[model samples]
Target chain A: MIAASFGAGGMNMLDSQSRDLIVGHGSHRYKVDVHWGRLDPGRVPVKDCHEMAVDSQGRIVLLTNHIRNNIIIYSKKGKLLQSWGTEYPGAHGLTLMNEGGEDMLYITDTERHEVIKTTIDGRVLMVLPYPAEVDAYEDASQYLPTETAIAANGDIYIADGYGQQCILHYNARGELLNAFGGKGIEEDKFENAHGICIDTRSGKPELLITARQQNKLKRFSPEGKWLANIDLPGAYICRPVIKGEHVYLATIWSGDGAENTGFISILDKNNRLISAPGGNQPIYHQGNLSPMYQQLQLFKHPHDVCIDEDENLYVAQWNAGHLYPFKLIRI
Target chain B: MKAKHRGHSSILFLQKIALAVCSIVALWGCSTNKTFSQENDIRLSAPIPQYSSTLFEDSFCLSFAPGYPNSHIHFTTDGNMPSRKSAIFTGKQCFTQSIHLKAISFHPHLQASEMVEIDFLQVKRLEKVKAISLLQEPSDSYPGGGASSLFDLQKGSLNFREKAWMGFDEKVVEIQLEFEKPQKLSQLSLSTLQDHGSWIFLPEKMEVISQDGSVLSQWPIPQLAEAKRLAYLHVSLDEIETQSLRIRITNADVIPDWHPGAGHRPWLFIDEVILK
Candidate 1:
């Protein structure tokens, strides 16, 4: 394994803009590893480094839309392991699941409007196409899948965040079970529902989804019943990542104008944001989260974050000059 | 044997020089876009210039305070991106008539900040407001400073949520501003924000009327065939006399079919209403 230490000599390799800086606060503070993943673009080009996931073998898997190598796997030490796949042109989301003792992956492609199930080595398992049965969608172009969540029973929940603000449920066999939520003015409706995840934190399985444009997270029953709404006044969160009793998020953008201001947030069991990795301290006035923004410009459009077994974070960004992921080693 | 050993040493020296050159090039490439440390972040928007409510004189001189230390501020009044060649604010500036001053701060190694624009209008101040009312209230998110915001003589930035612009969604805005006494008005103008992609559009039409139900002037806001930048719409009325000014601004109603929010309700944002 490559050494994780950045001794005195290695400091000279960092850019003058970011030589030695620490971000985050409280229990989530981190020391940045800027040179964690440096690959020659000519050899392995990446467009938008959208999302990341860690496999059971501890290999950090990154999903980019770059057709040459859609999936780039790296070691915990930031060494390149292997990369494969070129069929997915608009690879946006990646979800790694361990099924029957084997690691599997679900990739959502917005360009083709479909959800693909593949093995760790790029073998196609099942393809969940657009929902033709839904009356709201007369054709396939109206459904753009952005994310997915797997249930304990192998049910797959797909979030159509780009084209339509809704969630599609499919059983283990890839059969559509139900579709709910849409663009509306109702309290339970969504506006740019970008990410979704199955939450089992409260002892019962439920759904936690991101209403990105509205800056809120909506919780629903496994059957798609609206349970509650968590308001994050100014944060446009990408996805809800559950690790143990804490929930992590990569805020893609913030501010009233939706500028390219982004940061990482950590919430406690009750869903109260207690820590922001690169932003202001979480302050609540009468139970409402005041506007939050990037206190340290450490992240620009942080689309998703993958936490390893060591609790280190790998942050993938979007539209940030084609840079690779940044490693945040927990302090 | 001596000559052969000397030749081998010379070749080794040349190889060492080539290795040093390659290492320098590699280090330079790595420094191009390294991840930023927290302390080197680009500062937020430049501080807005502080000025008076109205200019009573024909021409006025203004000054600016530095927003970020160790930074150079470039300013422009023609609605263009300020460059290094632009006017570097030394201390103050002088202006005649009305001008929109947009400025940005630039630090050496940090990123440039977003532009901050403020408008200074040279108009006569009214004695007092008799009464004011709005036919339709603005959206709760951007009620602005309320009816008083229209006369605050301050322009809104591209960011309309700065508590300066009153935003109306799919709704017409009818405002009546009564002066302390009847005054002869020759010109009337208002500014609206046009960020089409964000679902904000210029008002379709504007009508100015008098308390006696006489139409002073009416004009249609022209839609830009192609809008690639954040834009503003300023419409002025001809000479007219009125006691109470009744202004009506019609919204675009629905976004154009070519827009991403084609079927959604478009927003109308108005920052300052200038009456001369």
Candidate 2:
């Protein structure tokens, strides 16, 4: 496996402002296998990027919370392929659905208070409204969704992301099947329950959620049973990807510091610690101040991580607005 | 013989160099995205709190603490941390005038506050709390409600669907409140952006809860009606003395009598819940 970047060797890869990713790069000769950071020089050239989803064909889709305009799609890398939805003024959540390399992309627009499905080519396939349980009607704010997860039977799990902080489940037809989660510090209680992913770590369709404020990773059954509470130290936990048997998690930083160091950590299925490769330190920028002039080898925030078929790992960073790709090669 | 041996040695040397280059190339730029085999050489600490700040009662309240400088302080007087920053906390001199209060300092380590309550009489909402927009107003869907729905097409609700549908219509939607005491109710207005349907299902009973399950106040709404537009209710507090008050919508109207949206569903549109 390989972690690819714009280029190698800190050679001012981008014309815009640069952000460096600091992973554990051992010395050259003794390093039988090591990982290095390459600068992705191209600017994303978008207004605001909040949520992202990659289709089976490796197409990148994103939801922005900026204006009514939402849901932008791009190529596998940093290339801006195309854009759509001046209609979704309050778009925030998105996910790709179906089996057999399906081209369907599902989106949630808080502004319009609706979940929509379309082709990867960007045509409105179907319009799914809120489930009967959520007061999206009469309470427009309740319709405001933050994130989305797809079920095997084409059912959609919409995290009433911002509206009511609840998990609203809908059949593939956009029918509200069941709903779970509320605003609380309790087990299934969500405090800005931001991001979610479907996990089979428990050998079932378990809903894995990142409750932002509570600072925990919570797993729930499809019928909404409290499975486990993932304990971590950071205040904000961003997006999570449950790969095979491991989870690579980091921070959602608005500032710099090793505290919010944005370290990439590996945790097992039961929500216990597997390990944090570089402790909790991620790659960071060194501000002139020098402990022997060491550039920060920690992270600001590692927003999203994806594992390709080859087990190559790609991470999306929020603050730096950079995409860091790395290969998981065991030496 | 010497030349052949020399050539073999040189070729072997080049082969060695090639191996070194490949090893370096493979080793170079490896990602630390996975877990570290051993604990990395690092230490994790909290954001240093000892920094000065400014509370722009209307614009922005910034805390100058070290570490995670990007951490936004999303707080509320109703003891709710809804969004990153969605609380409507009112301070003295905060209504219409822009109140600029010097941001106090943070002690870095404690993550505690030297300043908790920003004088309410001096703080106000940066933007006006939106009013109840009835599908029409200078409305977002001003053309008409029938023309295009306001909320979600993936129609579902927490109250009437899950909470009410699961048991009875008892789970209360946590609205805002007076953290210290009650305020004015004259300019009280309600605007809703409909997601799917508009129907406030109320039971034959009403129970008021104040920190306990005991009824603090009780009222009964004996009917269920088809709300043409968003539902609106207003209560005026004389001196504003209620604390942690909950108004649970108890009456329910289900389609199948088992689950909601079983046959067909209605909608309620709301854009904002403004109580001035």
Best candidate according to lDDT: 1
Native-to-model Cα distance after best TM-score fit, residue A326 in candidate 2, in Å: 8.6
Candidate 1 lDDT by residue in tens digits, A250-324: 998765534456888888899999888766667789999877765445677899999999798999998777889
Highest DockQ: give the candidate number.
1
- The recovered share of true contacts, given per candidate in order, is 0.14, 0.00
Interface RMSD of 1: 16.2
- The native-contact fraction of candidate 1 is 0.14
Error of 1 at B243 (Å): 16
DockQ scores for all predicted structures: 0.09, 0.02
TM-score of B-chain for each predicted structure, in order? 0.63, 0.24
Error of 2 at B170 (Å): 40
Q: Which portions of model 1 show Cα errors greater than 4 Å?
A: A1-19, B1-38, B41-117, B120-157, B160-275
lDDT of 2 by residue, A1-331 (tens): 0001111111222222222223333210011112222222243233334456566766656655444335555554445566566666666566777555667777777778787887776689788766554553455556677677887777788777576777888777766778788788778788877778788777778888888656677888888888887655443566567667876554553222222245455555655544443333222244221111111224445555555444444444554433332223323
Find the 10 residues in a row with the least total lDDT in model 2 chain B.
B104-113
Error at A236, model 2, angstroms: 1.7
